[model samples]
Target chain A: MRRGIGFWTGLGFTLLISAFLILPVLASVIAGVTANQFVGLSSGLTTRWLVEVWANYGGTVLLSLRIALATLAVTLLIGIPAAYVLARHAGVTARLVEEALVMPVAVPGIATALGLILAYGAVGDLRASWLFILAGHVVFCLPFMLRSVLAVLLALDLKGLEEAARACGASWPQRFLGVVLPNVSGGVLAGSLMVVTLSLGEFNMTLLLHTPFTRTLPVGLADAYTALRTEMASAYTLIFFVLIVPLLSAMQWAASRAERLGR
Target chain B: MSVAIRLAGCGRTWPGGSIALHPLDLDIAAGETLVLLGPSGCGKTTLLRLIAGLEAPDAGGRVFFDGEDVTRLPIERRHVGMVFQSYALFPNMDVAGNIGYGLRVRGVARAAARRRVDEMLAMMRLDGLGGRRIEALSGGQRQRVALARAIAPRPRVLLLDEPLSALDARLREQLRQEIDALLRSLGITAVYVTHDQAEAMALGDRIAAMEKGRIAQIGTGRDLYHRPANDFVAGFVGDTNRLATPEGERLVRPEHLALRRSATGGFTVVQATFLGPVVRVLLRDAAGRELRADVPDEDVPAPGERVAVLFQGRSLETEAAASPA
Candidate 1:
């Protein structure tokens, strides 16, 4: 095919926007390795800042991973069945309930966190525990999980599939395990990735919910940027990317696979 | 082995209080193939679902399988096989896995299930396609897999709900013949539902014609066509014209009507349509009553010509309209 002016123009515009989005991350990567970010790249490159950031915030990184995994598990356990019910019922009550689940996503996460703290703050055990932050992460990440699974459920002929299973003499539990779970596994995979990504990066809720000892990666990154040098903060950002890029790539792969499957 | 089925006062009313099927009784002898024939919303599907245990009947209604009460049983416990119009094959499973699912669910050993699956694959002419994915198959192949899956477990009864309605006309005819052969070979009691009269006539040993949640009539295809109990059945079974006679309104099939040359007091030929073997002639009388007659193409009269309509066989009275004198 022959090149056209419009095609070149659109390509140039897309490249320009991509550069605009990626330049900041590239600068951070450069700064994270620089011997002295204040003196610019000509000074030298070294891993000293990265080593310092890891030594200072390694526990926070592990805590973030723990909280993200917990959030993923809890959201999936509750969201999948809730989505199933919402998909099957499809009445006013189900609609209202679905909207209520989405309320956390629509409202600012800080407000939701504040509300949770105000309601449960009286209990010292819960308020001081890492599970308190896990609760806030679950609230923030659940809507995405439910929405993903519900989208797949609503698009499928699940009721017909269930009926077919029943006619084959499968009990309810057997049908759920054998038919429903396999069919919705793609949705569950995509949703789990979303939950982990959101929970790992979540700051607005964690800012209000986290205690000094229960600090997550994002909370620690914020504290490092404010209390430490710019190079240390940039190194923390690089580490965050290292932890999250694989999950993002897996999500992309799942999305394309679902498209290929025509679901 | 096939089991006889009996429904005593079975009916269904939707949650919103709309009657989907009125209370009715029906019986199917062991190894019989009964087709429920009706247009959409005529309650044919509701009756089939009631028998399948997918829907419970209204109070005072009961369903029996081999004279055992199964009214309270759910579909999972009913032990019936069903084929749906959409073919509802598990997309996650391969053809062999889909065919073997029922047996596995019934706690059959893995090797035994594999044998049954292979047997079904051969029976349905799906050899060499057992490992193929569902999305890789054609519509006809998917339907064949659905049938293989349904019958692999050898359930006591088979319920097919418009299974061929999704296929093209040519494929529908082919699969219809295949289904008829399979039913005969299995000798399993089956309840087939369809809106196509030709399909009902071809596959059913007996057909229960339903209308507005009620059974209009039940008989063999010959009985429904030649000796319909009422006008609805007469018109529903085949092409028919109602003619006013001294006795009353009489129903005559287009095949039975013969066109004759006449001057007046008969029908004037309005149009002639040649359809391969026979030409259908449309006629109108002075009373403005219209009738269609299928005559030999060689003897077709041109439009605006006058012809008398002759009844070749016995004309039926519209019992729905009035008593036959």
Candidate 2:
């Protein structure tokens, strides 16, 4: 009887926790679709706000895609080698390197953003441009890319695969292209997706270092909020939300597949 | 087909006080299987890796392949085939792709590579398994795929690092014979690493026993079994009952002992055990010093039974100093 009661309590707690987390998103979706606009509430299911934001608000969408792709390419080039060294090397030096890579992840994103702004903002001679925005995105996305790829790299059986390739007369580059790359491709995809997501959602760094011409999606969205463009801002948020939800879901799906693959 | 690989003072010491291998000289001959048999951490794997050029020896040491110094060459240029303890099949590739990896890397045309892969697949008895992903393969299947990959390019040398250690006993025994036959048929100079004495004796044409970063002894299985070089080698190569004589030492194989029906001399049977075809009798002297003997089942002795035993006087006792050289 006591076991049955305990089971019921646990199940109830899980349901309530899930509901608590999901309720706000559900409410926002209903509000987004149903709220009365200046055009007509009787047509109620109108997408006028989405159309207005897409047409007149800003070029936030384009900026977000650009930053995300650049971050993806740069992060992969840096993260793969960092992960390989950490995973393959043994002893104190490798451990120290691993911890150093993880240090930025332990730091708050706001701290990094502020530090960049101070260094490159009014005090530094460099003017804020798309270049500065990309630089910030790279810094912000580095930890995420490294962590995800490193996890996969560590989980792999390096001696097994590398030895097999070496024995098969595979040159180092061939081994990298054929054996190492294929095994780590899933991790790369997942890490690249993560970098893109982080770049797209970055608000703090974008706001601090953004120029009028170089504003990212999140920064533009915040500017819209300050100017009393709540409805249009909400529409922009919905579009951003639409783009992000799929990406995040895909990431979750990939993560679960990685788990099932058992590395 | 004849070849000889000479290791002229090969050595390697990783950072942080781990001595992976000590400077050593040895020769490996073509169409011969040399098993480096030792306990874990005894540098057996390190020796195989060094020979394969996966790891370089210390600056002064050199590795010679077929009379050519290949120590500085990269692993690919060395053209050595290696099978790891883990199967190491490429997870992303189908069985065919994994098998054809070496051929493709050697710049074989894609169509020709595929044909070679098919031939290797059939050779390894993996005909229909070509399209399956590595993840879909069973342990034995994966191991065979790895074997096929290693043999596909017909490398001059084959190195196996504890190849059968991962399999169950029955499978290990079965595959040991298969791999032995395969290596012999290919006429390749092979170095097999394992701590299993049974495996070493069963597969190695000559076995090099190692301990604590040095070779303990190198001999044919029968030679090492009957005439081990030292106390460590006697204990490691196979089971033995060792006794200290007024001289250096005397070791006797359990089976070499002859158990008589009566205590005609100073020996007495303390215990007896039936072990299928043979009966193992534990003998002792007046000083409670213990010894063991293995005789045919019909000559079985009971506990507390008195027995006469004799020692054979053939041994390479002076050969101890020359070992581990």
Candidate 3:
């Protein structure tokens, strides 16, 4: 297709905005590799800050991974079947239930976290555990998973497919496992990525919910930023990027591949 | 092994207290294709669903397969095959995977399932296309895959819910003929549903013309054309025009009505549509009683021309026309 001058102008403007957004992150990555942030790269590159960040905050990184996976598992377990059920009914009741599920996402994260603490804070074991923060993450992440899968289920010819499966003599388990899951794989993948991403990066709710012992990566990064040096904080950011980028890249590739495969 | 199906007072009612199909008894003979014919919302599909075990009949109702009571059996236990108009082929699976899904779920061994899938592909003229994805195939091919998948399980009864309605006119006709042959060759008791009267006529051994929530009439195409039990069946199964005969008003077809240009005739040609083999002419008399006649294109009178109408060939008095007066 031929493009007019307007397209070139738009491309230039977009590039300018991208550079503005990306230049800071690039500078941080460079600072992380430098021996000293004040002297910049001429001070000579070294892995000491990166190593220091890993040693000081490695447990938090591991805890964050655990939280993300736990949150994802909970969402998938409840969300997929919930989506199917809600998709099938599609009445006012179902809509009401969906909106209710999404209420946590719509409200302030800290408010939701405060509600959780008020309800469960009486139990000392529950309040101090990473599971408390995990609960907050699940509440925030589940709606994304449910809505993603629900949208796909609603868009599909789910009734026809179910009827066809039943008429083919397939048991309920067989139909769900073989037919429903494979057809909705794209949605499930997208939802999983969103759940994990949100759980990992979630700050405000996690901030209020987490105890010092249950510190997640983002909380640790904030601590490092406030109390530590620029080089160390920049190295912590680099570690965060290292932990998240490959996962994001893998999910993006999988989604594109699934798109190429027909629904 | 096809089995006779019987629905004894089988009916469906929604949770909202709306009746989709009123309690009615129906018997379908083994190896016969009984089509449920009606316009949408006439409960034809509801009846088919009742037979397929997808919908249970209301209280005091029962379904029997080959004289064995199967009213309580769900569709999986009933072991029936069904094809939908949308050709609901599993998009994730290739053609062969979709066809063999039934057999695989039924516990057929991998090798045996492959052999059966191959046989079904050949039977449906889908050879070498098994590796193709469902989305890769054209509409007709997808429908053929749907048919192959349904029949692969060797179901005792096959249910097709307007399977060919999604295709273009030419493809629909071609596939219709192929399906007719397939049903005949399989000899499995099948209940087909469609709103198209012509399709119902072409494929049904017996057509059940439904109206509202009940079967208005059930007979062969010829029987329906000649002897509709009521006005609904008469109008639905085929075009039937009212004729004011000497004895009383009677139903007639456009082909049976003869139109001739007459200077003194009270009927005026309202419109003449040339439809290739025949020209459909609409005429209205002084009383505004409209009559339609199909004639050769050469005999078409211009619009507003006066014409006389006469019933020929076989009128209401014909031996086959035994419908109640």
Candidate 4:
């Protein structure tokens, strides 16, 4: 017998939507990489604009990497504990805390950036450093990271492992670092990858608060677009694709592995 | 090498005023495996956790390991090993790492830990499977791994919470025997929790029958089965047909009721099922009290046949309405 109408229809719909969304990005990226510079779609392969952008704005690209890495580190340090506590601690207080953590996800990113800028700018200190940008990125990404980590943590057999580790004479720290962390490694890695990708591509906050030294790749590309350089902007987008694709692919693979293990 | 564990007036009540465990007094002798037998919500697992120091009891409760007070000690300091019902082997670690975990926690050298793990694996009959990942192991294999992990550190006490409940019937029976032998060989005091009375009887030196956070009876398997102190214990320890009397109660086991060919007997067989080795006869008395009698398969009566049933004289005694003061 057939596997039912819903199953085939679902698969067909998924394939149709995936092609609809992905084909355009693929075609544009290819054209951006191949078209001759400044002539848009003129014949022949030419990566000359890519080379120039790399040579000139390599520093901005590295800054983006640093920002993304810093954001990832900060999110993990804060979000994991929050997620773990939310998952492990029982009672109404934990429920309230979980709800509060989820509130950030409901807020629009542009509004969050605006509020963060206003709040930090009101302090009138450290407004131009990477710290401000990092803080903003953290506020925006904390919800996703916490949600991701906490979902996995909630699914885990926490009490069982904790009891097993304690029975083994493991100290509290040893239990957390050895038993607990290893069990949630997939969740933590997934959260870190999310923060990295989001922070790297973040444009709203960076555009509102970009400086000479702290210009992220997205902000730099926006600035190049403002200057009416389509060839250059396309080149910058190509550069971004090159840098983000590998990390995104790696994260996707890790997530899929975790999902497969679960299945 | 028998160890003794004592709990003095132990009780636990949650914050919302729900009692998880009521005041309990128990003495488990060394080299004996005591199974706490009860149904769901009976707090058998809670009692095991309390003694293991995974949970703390409220005021006026104390636990003793070898006559030393350990009521307030955290689980790590209690020197007790607990096997979870789910087995809870660290999925990230291979079988060897999981078993050696306890040793590594206590600052044992890798060489020594591995050596102990090797012995534990061999004891659990998992000698060559140490390097295999826990996820790669079958359910029975994982259960053995969990047992090996708990016993590797050689703690003073071992607490098992429904350790064999996850296995199929054949595997559960086999593992139950192996586990009993292993516990006997190690001479470690063990408190096992289970809802299966058969398992409790087969594995326990003494069985504690619990009901609603209180111990109904604690005695040898024979005593608990043959001489249960109350209706709850009587009905729990075996298949007891509780018959209401004018004064109090009478509980009779299926084997205690004899089926014979007589019209003057207490009851007549209404139906009979030939259950391979034994025959089950359902009978109804003059007062319409239904009783079950188990007879040998060869003597089983046909459907709609008449059979006489008899009960021991002492089985007619009525149980007291109230629990012992």
For residues B1-325, could you state the per-residue lDDT of candidate 3 as single tens digits? 9999998998889999999999999999999999999999999999988888888889989999999999999998899999988888888889998999899889999999999999999999999998998889999999999999999999999999998888999999999999999999999999999999999999999999999899988889988888777767777766777787775667788888887789998799999998888888988989999888888878579999998888787654333234445
Task: Judge candidate 4 against the unseen true structure and give its global Cα lDDT, from 0 to 1.
Answer: 0.83
Clashing pairs in 4: B2-B30, B3-B30
Compared with the true structure, what per-residue lDDT tens digits does model 1 show for residues A57-119?
999999999999899889989999999989999799999999999999989989999999999
- The residue-by-residue lDDT of candidate 3 on A83-160, one tens digit each, is 999999969999999999999989999999999999998787999898999889999999999999998998899988
Tell me what TM-score chain B of candidate 4 gets against the true chain B.
0.92
Candidate 4 vs. true structure, TM-score = 0.90
- Please tell me how candidate 3 rates in CAPRI terms: medium
Whole-model lDDT, candidate 3?
0.90
lDDT of 4 by residue, B88-202 (tens): 8887788998998999889989899988999998888898998898889998999999998888888888899999999999999999999888888888989999999989999
Q: What TM-score against the true fold does each predicted structure earn?
A: 0.96, 0.88, 0.95, 0.90
Collision pairs in model 3:
none
Q: Which stretches of candidate 2 lie over 4 Å from their true place?
A: A1-16, A33-43, A122-126, A246-263, B16-20, B243-249, B263-265, B312-325
Name the top DockQ candidate: 3
Give, for candidate 4 chain A, the lowest lDDT window spanning 10 residues: A34-43
Quote the lDDT for A116 in model 2: 77
Q: Which regions of candidate 4 fall more than 4 Å away from where they truly are?
A: A1-48, A247-263, B242-250, B264-266, B312-325
Pick by DockQ: 1 or 3, better one: 3
For candidate 3, what is the DockQ?
0.67
Tens-place lDDT digits, model 1, residues B12-49:
99999999999999999999999999999999999999
What does the lDDT come to for candidate 1? 0.91
